[model samples]
Target: MTSDISHVRSLTLDEALHENPVGWFQYRLLLMCGLAFMADALEVSLLSFLATCAGADWGLSTAQEASITSVVFGGIICGTMFWGVFADKYGRKMAYLAASTLITVGGILSGASPSYGWLIFFRSVAGFGIGGASVPFDLLAEFLPTSHRGQFLIYIEYFWTIGSMFVAGLAWATLSQQGWRFLA
Candidate 1:
């Protein structure tokens, strides 16, 4: 009985290590997800910063600025509804990739926006990317085994928080150095 128990323990440890191999693929996947989370946080933070800039630069009233913020959130809601269903029908990898692409395009367009309306439109598009990313983010949690799922999900959240903080720091640095042009 003692020998049998030892053998079982060794086998379990070996299987655990093998299943969670440390390789370039896993690192790349983690980095990709981390970047997605960073983009998600950056978009929301940029919108908040843009509101103040827009209000001052474009002569927008408080109410109008608030509406701009609300529109971005509304876009996020629509995106979640649109992408979540499609991700369920398709696959998480593709959904994640598409979300990243949307985010990149939105960022570029927002930087080039010449008017308040244009900025708001691009902001909404970025919000859509964020919402789409969330679906696959949840799917990644489900993809892992029960034992490691919780740990990985928690790690993902930690990375997300890190990304948020990074964006906040960047905003502060950019604004301090160059002012509202940082929005562009």
Candidate 2:
């Protein structure tokens, strides 16, 4: 009986938000979520550059280099399933923040890695954090009015392209001149 009331109340809240005019809340959400998307893309772009640099610096074999890069994908696969469940049990915002933190810590640790083995471990950690894309993709839509949701989602996606370009330029400017550790 009470459960039914809870469900209806939740729907009512969603209804009210949908009816609300487009304003700062929606815009702010767009900015934050877009940044997340951009960061995810940047991290992915950085991987190839970083992996190549690491390979040369560490004198790694082709298979070892590939393994270092491929491990991140494995982590992402596991993290998606893990983070999706985590968001459902906890909340999207919480999961997103946690994932962002993981990405940051993992990235820092990866940059500081002394060997190929450590790099593989840290990159996988970052990849796991990357899997928490649920919040950016799903949460934004829930808050947005149906009329504007499509445009906003599209806007959010544009950041990915920008991030890739930014990384490419950054890599071009620095990777050739500096050591991998500096760029990493």
Candidate 3:
């Protein structure tokens, strides 16, 4: 029989993935997911620095400072639940956009907080956004070939260390002489 492209057999999803070569698209997906993970890590690590500087500036008691952390964690818990369900119902993309919007708005306003109450409120907002960390990770993993999934997932996790280090450097550079708002 003469060769013909029309005779090509359809590959199963697994077969297709295994047969396909890794390329820029996969690499780009990894970069995007890793950055999202890094942002999540940086925001979580920032909790202590913001609380300390704000506490000193505002004369907040130890319990009050601790409350800031508590509220953020609380928001994280709630957001994880809400976003997970939202992702399940609407879509990961929609949930991610909503979460990102919250993070941007909340984090910026956090720096502008004038009182302990406002600080906690904005941190809660950011924490809620941070809770959507799994969305990008899941989205990336779903797109990656099975062979590359584990390695890429691990690489994505390394962004957390990078984020932690980044936050520390930021605090060291500006926390001492700067206003809480500036360091925030």
All models, RMSD in angstroms: 6.6, 4.3, 2.9
lDDT of 1 by residue, 16-104 (tens): 64577455654566667767776777777676776787678789999988876786788788888888877877877778888778777
lDDT of 2 at 56: 86
Q: Which tens-of-lDDT digit does each residue in 1-184 have in candidate 2?
A: 3344554444575678777798998899998888888878877888878878898888998898888779888888988999989988998888888888877777788889977889899999989998886667777887887888899999998999998999888888887777666555
Better of 1 and 2 by lDDT: 2
For residue 75, what is the lDDT in candidate 2?
84
Per-residue alpha-carbon lDDT of candidate 3 for residues 1-184, written as tens digits (9 for 90 to 100): 8777997799877678779887898889888778877878888888878777788888999999999888888988988989889998998878878887887788889899877888889999999998898888877777778999898889989998998999889888887777667745
Candidate 3, residue 168: lDDT: 88
In candidate 1, how many Å is residue 85 off? 1.3
Q: What C-alpha lDDT do the candidate models reach, one value each?
A: 0.71, 0.83, 0.84
Candidate 1 whole-model C-alpha lDDT, 0 to 1? 0.71
Return the lDDT, model 2, position 96. 83
Q: What is the lDDT for 20 in model 2? A: 79
Which runs in model 3 stand beyond 4 Å of their true positions? 1-12
Question: What root-mean-square deviation over C-alphas does model 1 reach?
Answer: 6.6
Ranking by lDDT: 3, 2, 1
